[model samples]
Target: MPRASLWFIRTGLLALAAGFTLGALLLLNKGLPIYPGLWRLLPAHIELLLVGWTLNLALGVAYWILPRFIRGAPRGPGWPVWAAYGLLNVGVILACVEPWVASGPWLASVGRALEALAAGFFAVHAWPRVKPHGV
Candidate 1:
């Protein structure tokens, strides 16, 4: 597997762990009343599992398997994909912590915007590779 692919998969797993942890904490709080209103973190947990984990894993696999632009370049332009990775992780980080911060709403909005931009980058990078191969 490629380094990028590994990074994506590992990061996704980490996100999965984080999501589960948050869920467990929520459950614990419900049973013991440790943290009041921990329910607010629900959206963060969902985002971590869905966008941070699932989406990144899918994108990483696509990057690994998709047809390249030329024989010399299997993954096409490297920067855009790297940018997508960075953007996604950063956005997820910001989003996950948003609920606990004072500037949460604004930060969450920015995080969402970043995630959207990351998706756009992935789409643009993957567009040409979507067709069937002649071989």
Candidate 2:
């Protein structure tokens, strides 16, 4: 596996752990009412699990499994994928905190835009590699 893939997978696992922890807390709160504030974590939990975990894992696998060029860098330029990784994580964090901050709506919008940009970056990196076999 590529180093970038490893990083992406590891980050996704961390997000999964955090998301599951939050989910457990939410579930517990439902039965025991430990703290009503736990409810606010719902958005964060969803974002972490869906975008953070799922998207990261998917991207990591896609990056690893995508076809490579016969010459030069096997994966093409690494910066865009790295940028995707960074932007994605930051976006997920911003989106997750959308419900907790005073500037939530704006932050969430920015986060979503960043996430979209990350996807565009990843697409740029991946597009060339996605060709017929033995091209």
Candidate 3:
């Protein structure tokens, strides 16, 4: 596995842990009513699990498994995927904080936009790697 893939996967695992922790707290709150403020974590929980964990892990696996060029760089340039990784984490953080701020909607929107852009960057990195049979 490439270093970038390792980083992506590790970050994803961290997000998964955090998401599960929040989810457990939410569930406990539902049963015990420890604090009503725990309800505000719902959006963050969803964002962390969905985008942070799922997307990051998927991207890392994709990066590792995707085909390589027959010539030149094996995995193509590394910068785009690195950018994707950075943008994705930043976006997830921004999105997860959305519910706690007055400008939440806008922040969430920007976060989503950044996520989409990160996808585009990853796509750019992965596009040429996808090929039929033995090219």
Candidate 4:
């Protein structure tokens, strides 16, 4: 497999780990009374899995696959790819503080939206017909 394919799998595994960790934490919180409210952990766990894991995996696949576009020059990683990665991580990080801060949900939502926009950027780079086989 290619190096980027490995990145995709690693990202997916990280996402799964985050999800499992969330479930375990929830159970622990309930049984051990680790915190006041278990619901407070929801956003952080969700974003870790969804944005950090899922989004990162998707972007990794895109890095390997999207270069078929741009016709003449191959699409290389630099500004656009880095921006996507940064936006996704930023969303996840913001989610961690979202529960305690009260105003965190709104901020997390904006981060999520920005991450989605970054995905759109990848799609644009992967524009149809750029591939020789037209996949």
Candidate 3: worst-modelled 10 consecutive residues by lDDT:
126-135
Model 3 TM-score?
A: 0.96
Candidate 1: list runs displaced more than 4 Å: none
Question: lDDT of each prediction vs. the true structure?
Answer: 0.86, 0.95, 0.95, 0.66
3 or 4, which is superior by lDDT? 3
Give the better candidate number (1 or 4) by lDDT. 1
Let me know the TM-score candidate 1 reaches against the reference structure.
0.90
Better of 2 and 3 by TM-score: 3
TM-score of 2: 0.96
**What order do candidates take by TM-score, descending?**
3, 2, 1, 4
Clashing pairs in 2: none
- The TM-score of predicted model 4 comes to 0.69
Error of 2 at 12 (Å): 0.3
* TM-score of each prediction: 0.90, 0.96, 0.96, 0.69
Full-model lDDT, candidate 4: 0.66
Worst 10 residues of 2 by lDDT: 126-135
> Scored by Cα lDDT, where does model 1 land?
0.86
Model 1 lDDT tens row, 2-109: 788888888999999999998899889889997788899898989999898898899889988876655656667777888889899999998888888999989999
Least accurate 10 contiguous residues by lDDT in model 4? 126-135
